[model samples]
Target: MQDHASPAIGISDLPAREEGYVDLRSYAAIGDGRTVALIAHDGSVDWYPMPNLDSPPVFARLLDSENGGCFELHPAQAHSATREYIPGTNVLQTTYQTGTGKVRVTDSLNTGKSGRLPWGEFARRIDGLEGTMELHWRVAPGTRLNRVSPWADSTRQCPLLRVGDVTLGVIGCAGEELNFSDRTVSGTITVEAGKHRLIALISTRHEPLPCPDPEHILDGIERTVSYWKSWSSELHYDGPWSGEVLRSALALKVLTHSHSGAIAAAATTSLPEDPSGGKNWDYRFAWIRDAAYTLHALIRFGEREEVHSAVSWLLRMIRKQGPDPEVFSTLAGELPHSEHEVDAPGWRGIGPVIEGNRVGGQLQLGVYGDLFDMIDLYLEGGNVIDQPTARLLADIADRTCDVWHQRDAGIWELTEARHYTSSKMGCWHALECAVRLAEAGQIEGEAARWQTERDRIKQWILQNCWSHERQSYVWYAGSNTLDASVLIHAMSGFDRSERMSTTIDAVQQELGDGPLIYRYTGMQREEGAFVACSFWMVAALAEVGRKAEAERLMAQLVPLANDVGLYAEMIHPEDNRFLGNLPQGLSHLALMTAALTLIEKY
Candidate 1:
């Protein structure tokens, strides 16, 4: 509700093509826990999914700029724009300056007085800051991503657009009636200095539509600001780049599903990881590895209630899936299909816009350690584990002893299963945590077997995966490639020896792109820099007693994030453009982990 003096991002050089699609870096996110809407710097609501973040979007201009629908608002005359998040909140304020005047538009998916609203609300407040300005706005609620035909009915006092069972209502076009053409709603309004206007979009899914006046939506906006400020004030962090850390916390909250306590991997899906197409996958579902990392970060932030719910939810889902669970699952505890291509054209004409993740079917042995480590951290924070959950975890540790030798997808979820050294280390970490749990009397398991296998894994990795020539552990057995994933084992307390310390330098020399790091050795030609790998390296450096180097690398990495402190899944090292999904949870989680590791250990 209150705009602060954050640095403004100028949008004078926005990308423009035949379809008028801008770069992914030209957007900022606003959410109300259940869903997020991406507003481009040019005043277009490009991507918004209704009811849930994983649901089919009514506005999908980010994927298909032509047929994909959008909610657009900008000045009628030629102008330039600047954007920023109102401090301490996810609300976005975009100021457009024209030849005659300047106008400010504030965007938010409003919440209730205390918590989330029963329905979905998208509010935009317009204020005339100087001179007289005329602005144009439009709302079209349909996308080519799904099979829905939107039709406008001006029969009621307010204009309504219906898409299948969903009803979208438009309000606030003072002194002028809305124009309904085809399936789109459009209008124009003029305002002088010292005057303001309010426009809101209220929607419903498979239910009757409710007609609310402008003042009701306005109240929701105020409540939303209050809720965000209250939630953010609880995050206890005062380390270096404290502002960046707080912004990452707020961005992580945008990806968290409030109802189920499941954190999504990212907000939008099928945004290309590279420019030439290929490697597009849906990130709407929750990966156990990502959720575990998120839980670790939240615990370090001194958040109790949400961490409890997330640990319970994750453990419950893992238990439901029985042994050797897959990599990810839907927020509602359902399994996503392996993979499928949607019907829409992707961003920048990139095809094969995927709907589900292929990793859902792959066997990632590394997840065992992620699960056990999550439980270990939870218990370390003075939380108690129930008997049944403890027993189930003990059973999982037993299975890890049996499956440690089997080749699988590893942490990257590759199609070709290999004996990845990181996978073996993950299993070793899981067994070590199990032994600790047994020693603490939290779980009843075969501590001796776990210890034997853990030792065997350490010896095996040194024998088969280590390279005497490079003086670092390879990606897999009998290979010369180095993987950034090996950096994660440092945080597991797996290695403080000369091998890990030397491997850190090897990875830095082979994969480092300025401040960013690639995922692996040979894969640098395919994608941009993996956003979380650098953070993992930072934690690894701190773990290996190179505290000064960790501090310096952390300083470089924190400034690489976008102006609003939200990072995508990848970033182009050369051009500094955002690639892949926006507001990636793993990237933010790793950031919190690195920052906290420095504060706690070094």
Candidate 2:
């Protein structure tokens, strides 16, 4: 409620870190399935993708430090910080220790017990830990993907704004104002031990402010905490790394889209992995590969409802393509027709924060494998696949038979056309899962022909995709290049034999960095160690009966998570800074899969 545009200590006068940069892993993220909040270690919400997962960020200080608006709550002085989510929930508690005192900031995005929400609300509670400490606050609403700079106004009671049909109100609980702009606000406050303050950002597009009393906020906080505790209590993980597993479950829960059951790749888009490399890409959409892995994680954790919701979303997304096939869509289930850069400067010089994904139009053959496997998994659980969905599956499988030999954009969605062997193997995976599904009475398909097609695809891959000289599978048919994606075959049951174990070791030596691994060579410096590849390596290790190695590798990955137990698309092992989008669905889902695989096997 208190705004301090001017800091009492003038830290704002200091220039921000250079562009194309961030204090890597400085923030933890929390979400309510509808929207996500990024909380910095120093207790600032530097970025939030608002209204929807794919919407332009309204608060985007992470992208533009000086002009972009952010909400911060940290100790008055320079402080040391460590934070984590409450046991198994998305509520993050960050503790800051200053020369004078210590303080704790609990950050959460309010959600209902039924895994639903009245609307999206990001709430922060500040509790003094020792002597008095100073806290700062700022709110700057940005255009989605950091495009438009909307105006902000305070009318004594609330910070109100009108943009199109959207109406927003920012309310503070224990502070007063510093400065208010048509598009930004900042302030500072003092607090002592045993005292507390609260702040809430509420969105109301067509409705009244529904202004609740401060007492009501206190009540909401207690209720929300209790609900998350009860929900997480249902998890069944009991392993050597139960703590990491629980954290992964909580992160996956935060990424879940309550209304549609879709889980986004990450909360924000186009945050570069290598700040100096210009390797930025938007990750605010859903991928079928992530959905399949996320469902398994939810199921392993006994979150049947979330699993069901994710399945429904997957079905709806695929069903919308109407028995024909295309790449996946945004979490809202809309196709990404194209991509273009916004006019704004990149986050710390990471240029061209892209909007929309042209990859949606490319033939990502791997998607077919992910989809059929998800459907097979759902059926194996004794869940019924609807007739329409079954029909769609068969049609897609038939199409895979027709197109299995074609080149694709590849799993990384690279722009060039290449004979990506993993893409063809993905076709094999689809046909294999389809045959199994038909045998299990899940669909009506040409089971014999599909089986024959599956065998033929395998034969083709064995002859063309493998590199005899390297004694391992390569990225494509003719090249000796290695891709981390081939590790999935060993884990996906496409090949769990001795050859896979050798390939796994080869991948470790060739592409693995410490326990983290890359998808492939920079291939022109477009990527870092793809985080999901590392998880695939973890799962593959477990499947090949290398339990201890898998656990050790898994241990290495847990620390890579930011304080809130979230992961991006990739990581630089040397520096351990998260690259790509925050809380990426593939990364988190892969983490979940690796955890479950270790628990189930070891």
Candidate 3:
């Protein structure tokens, strides 16, 4: 398994400072009301989906570099690029300085207007900065992920309809036929210093021809930017880390399905949290764990409306499906009983790109903690915890008390079922929350029973999770594996005993390669150090009264962030290249929590 880490098809050997595509540094995120797109500093739409956040991506080069299509609006000449967002909005502006001239490209999706479904109309506006610059536009559709070649006929109101097996009516921009192929359209446009050209892509189920006029599309673009700025102003968070918090709030808002209220684990699927490591999992669906983080982040940012809606979505998942737990769906809002593969090529030869999460059916005891904690938060925020939420929490907590002792998949979603220490700790957390709720005069439940259950869980963790041999709590019972998750002990308040100290030292000594921490060495395969786990380690250090080490470790972690504050799922322990989904919610939330913990601790 360790050999997989040093694959024969080696990544670029050039110094990390010089590589271009190897680094995802030059892109910014833009969101319309419904979906988010990654726009590069070079004016290329690297990743985007149409009509819906869960819809198959129309521009997916971020996954399969060659087969996946892209929408580009970059200078024809070589250029230097810089990217940023308009204050308090998801409107991305990337400027390019070329040999011939400079151009400013703005990418955005409009949302929050009076009437708009949770669909997408991607808008790109290219403005000439100085001198005449030649701009290129290409619309390439791919066969991956059920994306089919578009049927182009300018005879109707919409010029092109890129139809696929599952997706219908993916609209594209048209002016002159530059070049058309099985799945692409390319052309060149020249703009003067003060002139601007606008392009838009709208996805509908009905394939229409002769796309709507560019001028009308430009109008939509203006309205979209206006809507983003307006809506962004409503966020009440002006916290210690306000900038990153706001960006997270914006990203989460974009990934959310307005109609369903499901916040996708990430905007992308199959982009390995660790490339070549097979750690990739499709995150296009909703996870109860992710939903918990979303609720917490929104609450931190003081977005109550989104908090209410997101909690409702989460409760819907718990309620619609009967008590027997299962894996949750992406947009459908239920557990998918089977692990069905979608007809999509995997990202960058990463095979078996899937839609539904198979963990839906697994017994994950951690969700018990997530649900109760989020409900408690909702009530504390003055929102009524719906009756369904109360009933569901009580039921799940009782069930956890009954079965948390049983072995199951850990938080990493590993294959084998075991007495994962973290899983049991999560059960302890849920009972603790129940006890807190009863004390706060919130709900009626057997709080004393829950307390007893909680104590039992703690006792079991100390007895079973700890390894006298390793002088630390191993991954689970009878295993000497040192996992980064054990560092979560301080954060979970499991114990501040010598056991935690021993566990932290063991993880740092064994799993900690430099500053980052691996989930577990060869627990499955050799992958980059898990970035979130690194942050968890930092948080744990702070809680365990190692402020100096915690501050130093955090300093190391923050620089791993890209040009923007986005941290991927993992990073190369050697060279800090991002591996996994961009702007991962878990990574960001961990960073936020760790920062807060350190701040308060110091």
Candidate 4:
């Protein structure tokens, strides 16, 4: 093991900022399948939650730059920075170039023999590539930043930072004597050419402080990188935009809960869809719609193991927790509760940072379509569905038939429930997919009854949703508003006629901002365009036999992804800046699906 006795250095002034915030696009994420850390271009770990993704953040400077905690390691002088992931892995490398020298910093959340380390370990390795550079480093454990009282205590071997039930051990420093003040530990050191250093923060909850072994920590980094590369190598996509597809797959994998097989809608929450506060909501929990789409994308790439685990988990959740399950749930399959505000200021001073989602109680009819489509895709991929799951699937199809005419939240989960055209179309899709499955002998269902209901729903949508005045399907009955969600009908195989193609043109005329599409009629005026909607348009175009147009629009849409090939929930049309949650599963899933469609068309 490497030495741990090097003395710490005194604290230095916190890094200065232009606006005290980094653009969401300027950050890359690293994770160990349990929790993720957001590292900015300037080498600051500004957002991280210890132990788990849903836990309160220990380093939240991304929210409250002045008071929230962060771990920053950067050159003392000014420098231009660039970053990338180690190929096929989540391990991130950031390079800084100054007037006289250059340095590279590698960051990773270490993985162990079984998988993610039971105890949290964040390791950073810095190497001087040329000349010499002075690096300033700090570990400011915000202790959830005043959520609880935190203090530092000196142990016989090293100092420990304690907050509530968790203890953080800081080790592998090679600076001056370490100083702990104001709930922060920091130091400065000089690294010359051909020299290097390592630092780590190991955390354990309600457990004894474990010694940090530097050599073992270094080995963990190699193992973690190898683990990610091995996983990436197993992916089977050989289609158009293969790199982007693989990156999306990797991002979706990062958001998955290793133990429960649940995938979060996004990695970070309360990052606003609109810079103005109200649109911000927590997305750390699993939504059935999002999970279904994620599984669909994975299944397209022949990711059997992940698909099976996720399907099994969902079936178990449905069997135990459903007749009608909540729109969203915890990774462990329990329904999420009400939304509440966190104490931290939201990103860029937007207030009322939220902790939970409020839409859990709403009725979204589209979920049945999503679930049945996921099951259909899995079965088509030669996977077997358990008897109980098949029964549940049949029951859900029947329920969709029973509820197709009812008013419920649409695909957007709008608070005002209505007879959304998309919801009815989804019901139609559920029944149709069920009929097909029953015909294939993949499941036991009332195929004749399902077909009858499916035809009824199709007729209902045609009669009520079509707007002759607008020459397209309206967002809902009696409203002239156009919703991008109707684009899903083309992908769902609801309509391949000339009317569907005309509807696509009308949707683009009203809701499209070139390649970026809005979720609904008026969202572009208030907030960013929904990223997934653009990809949905790509799928719809290809489905309508406009392959060249689909490829052209896709070419525009792919460039909007951030440097690391990850997408947020929305994008500012004018600035092209990312908005809302980072590493959004829906956005990535849409991208993957669009790529699959384009490849098939070509």
Candidate 5:
């Protein structure tokens, strides 16, 4: 309920780092839809990936502090600092106050006049407010990630630097004019009142380099801010927690690729879920389940263009690849064929820092349900599908009936495959939606067989998955394990009776850590609380006619996000530190679904 415009705590001495690495909680994300950069509270842009969100980093101090590259600017020694998003926008402003004066550093990824990023352009503008403030800045493109040394040529029109395959045009680089031996740039400046300076970086992958003048670079910063504000203004929800909802929408927007409309799971990858060591994952790839959830959320906010782009991209890739779609893909719809434990040390020395996701080949029965649910929502939103898409959905529905009984990785993507209760519910939900589509003549399929199979799934779950002693659905058929993922079925209209109502309380009692909920019963020891599970429970509670309880839980979970309202894939329950990849798309998507579910009832 606190205003995001108000600073969370007073501006104190800037955060200190441990072994050259700041806490994951200290990072906030800025992007131009394609590239996302993580700027820490200490004024360091630590994790920046050029070309796209899933690409290798240009500045990777987030992974390896010692040798990883970074774009940094801050007070030379000691300065107090506070940070916030420029209201209703992804542009970040950091205030630095030293003994002599105050200054603000505004950061953003520059977009074109058409309000889209055609290539990578990073703009950092410094403006002086009070007396003279001395600041230091650096541009070091580290080579540890891809194992290629950086090369620079000061002889070019602009200082040109190449890190791996990408070439960078460093404009307004403030270092000495003839300094190119070290392949890095560093400078110091004294800003008196009313003084301003600019540092812009333009990068290209395989194409010719871009030329951006100082005046246009400054103008690009304002233009990017304008684009973000205009995008946020189109959302039309004014219910309770609307401020937090809008921030979540903006965060999801940061994860949504403007060109392809495929939303990455998170901004950065290999941030450990278990801070002490293992369980690091590369979540930058676009998963079908996550994108489907994103589609559902954006539809609720009446987002048209993003929704259309995502739907088109998903179907095009699926049709091209076949009805049994691959689990995840690149932003450009390519199936990822490469994954590696890269050379860099991980955040806080968590080893085996990875680049691409390794779990894409796993069989997850829930994906069919996610796909159909998204298609159903898209149709209900008053859109028409082509004949090919309709036939594709029908083919997928037939395949779902064949594979629903197979033991596979559940929604949690755990290694031990089983007949997960939620997985069956997902299949059932998919078939049920297919039946409705067939009844409405949307998708051509065996409506009668789908209906029959849906009933069989319902009966099987009732007979084998229910636990008489616990009065709740089990995680799998034989075990009594509690899973928060089953709560998702409530919103899908799987169950709305006394059994589901009782199961909600039982899962909360077993999985809840106040407002935070573990993914399953025994997961508290392995990782932090899963962020999306808590929001899924809120929707389940509201769906089963427990409005007051849902509201109370919603109130608690809304403020649990970071100061700028971005969430990690998980949150440490004890210290509230971020765990897993940051600015997770599923967390924000779940937040929107929970809020819309609550608003629809009122």
Candidate 6:
């Protein structure tokens, strides 16, 4: 351990990028429950947003390497690096081994005593494990990619970075002075054997930002690590792939907003799904569908508090904004504003980085089922349903009955409205779950009407969505194309018949590349196979009693996760590179579900 306030000598010069770009898979995530930071294997904090997850990123080097800002602390000489989490915690440890020496660096976004800190706190601890090693550090805040220019204020005890209304302060304990130039703070320190160093970056939105004593910041890091470890200790899971399941659970917890209980779909945005730069969308907001799946995974692992809080937050949002909520909303329960393109060049020079989600207004009929399933899971976990939530569930169930037949955007949220088979099946599942709840006396509802509509929705799916010619349920009515989402019937219990088994085979044949499955027809040629859909296929395989195939697919898909077991929304099939938003909650949740299904069935 090292003293927190020990000053380090300043190095006036900056180091140039040795590597032109980093692979998306080379980044691992750490968060403080309010926002996440993506750190590359080379010890650079590439993507981080100050104050909140959706705020403009102060470090956007992941999107634009040259102009975007970053905080980097690595060996001045060439080194080989490997990293891992501090077991059961989001704190990451990276070890760099050079010809002459080895050094270990631990990174964390410190949480406060109670919950999230009012301001952001990032810490990097460096230790000399072998011989002496010279380490260089630079703190460069992008100010939303120069949308706001940054100024250095050296009048304080420690240097302060001022950009608009926000301020960032850098401090360390190495007995060296820091140099400030061009809004960047640069320093160098040599750590001999048995010596260590601690450097931190702190940010605040309020004017006259408070810079706590360095010793206090160090205490916060220790407390934050303990907090995460305690939370992980509470998780109860003994199924197959328990390690991966716990990793996914921890990743989901990182995505969860401590203040509002809203779980973001992912921590990042505008990591292109397509290399041609066509399909990029922001995923920092909460989607009803994604949140429902996240809850399902968490519930399986005996997580109760966050699930209850999330359900309560969602119900409150529904009450405030009415029963028909947006497909997505901010963590605080407001519809996200219109989508706009940012000026920053996207990852790999992909243009038109997006800000807000445009699909919030889309009528995704599956949300009805998503909400119902979340409530059912909560009640199944022995949690009581309040009166208002019970009534809201009943009303929403009735509304689903009324709108099950109408055409709308399906689970994929495509622009075109169609009689999607999966959407109708979702309504059927919702009504069926509602009927079961009514039978159990959890809520007051008309079971007969709900059953009748459920059967009707089933009949419609059987009549229109199925393609006898293709021997599978098509993506929608009157279309022969296969959809990966229809595999949800396996988990939703919409169907367990042999037809679903054949449909699973049909989907694999048409859209799957071995264990990885595309989202729908023709997607393999356009973009990478969706990582979630592939996991869904694994679950569906288990549901169909294809234990051998399920196990094989699980083995294949599990390795697709990066070194730290984090997943992005998509992966390029050709290169196995991560694409789209990282630490994707949907992908992690789907992986957990598939693991659970395999453990239960086999």
lDDT score of residue 214 within candidate 6: 77
Writing each residue's lDDT as its tens digit, candidate 5 over 58-99 gives 888999997788988888857787778887888988888888
Model 6 alpha-carbon drift over 4 Å, by segment: 1-20
> What TM-score should be assigned to candidate 2?
0.91
lDDT for each residue of candidate 3 in 1-602, tens digit (9 for 90 to 100): 00011111111222232222335544467665466788654566778776566677767776666666677676788666666666566677767677788787777675535736334567778898898888788766554455466554343454453556323222334455456665555678787899887766666554332244567667776776667666667766443455655665666666677777887777777666545635567677777887886686567556776787788777877787755455457666855544566655455455566655667677888878777777877778877665666676677767878888788888888789988888888889889888888787666777788889999999888888788888988888778786787676587677776677778899888888898888885732466777778888888988888889988988787766665456667788776776777656677767766766777677
* True-structure RMSD for candidate 4: 5.2
Per residue, candidate 2 scores C-alpha lDDT tens digits across 15-112 of: 33454235646657877767787866556677776677676666677776665656666665777766666655667776777888778777877765
RMSD to native for every prediction?
2.0, 5.1, 5.9, 5.2, 2.1, 4.8
Ranking by TM-score: 1, 5, 6, 4, 2, 3
Error (Å) of candidate 5 at residue 160 is 2.9
Model 5 error, position 444 (Å): 2.0
For all predicted structures, in order, the TM-scores are: 0.97, 0.91, 0.88, 0.95, 0.96, 0.95
Expressed as tens digits, the lDDT of each residue in 1-602 for candidate 6 is 11111121121122334444578887789999899999987788999987788988888898888767889899999777777787788898888777788888889999888888888889888888999899899988876865888777775467788866778888773357777797888889787778878889889886466677877887887898899888887788776677778888889999998888899999988988888887998999998888888888778778778888887878788877666767788977787999998887788887668899889778888998998888898889898888988888888888898988799999999999999989999899899899999999999987789999999999989999988888899999999999999998889998877899999989999998867888999887778889999999889889988889888888898877887779999988787878888989999999989988888787
Candidate 1 residue 523 Cα shift, in angstroms, is 1.3
Give candidate 2 regions above 4 Å deviation: 1-21, 112-115, 143-149, 161-166, 173-178, 522-526
Which predicted model would earn the best TM-score? Answer: 1
lDDT tens digits by residue: candidate 4, 1-602: 01111121111222345466888886788888788899877788998887888888888888888777788899899787767777777888877777778888889999898887789999998888999888888888775845876677766666688867878888787346777785778888677779877878899887887876788988888899889888887788777777788888888888888888888888887888877777888889988898899888888777778888898888878787665867788877888878888877778888768888889778899988988899899899987887888888888887887888899988988889899999998888898899999999878978889999999998988899999988899999989999989888888899878888888899899898878999989897678999999999999999999988999999999888877677989999898988998988899899989989888766
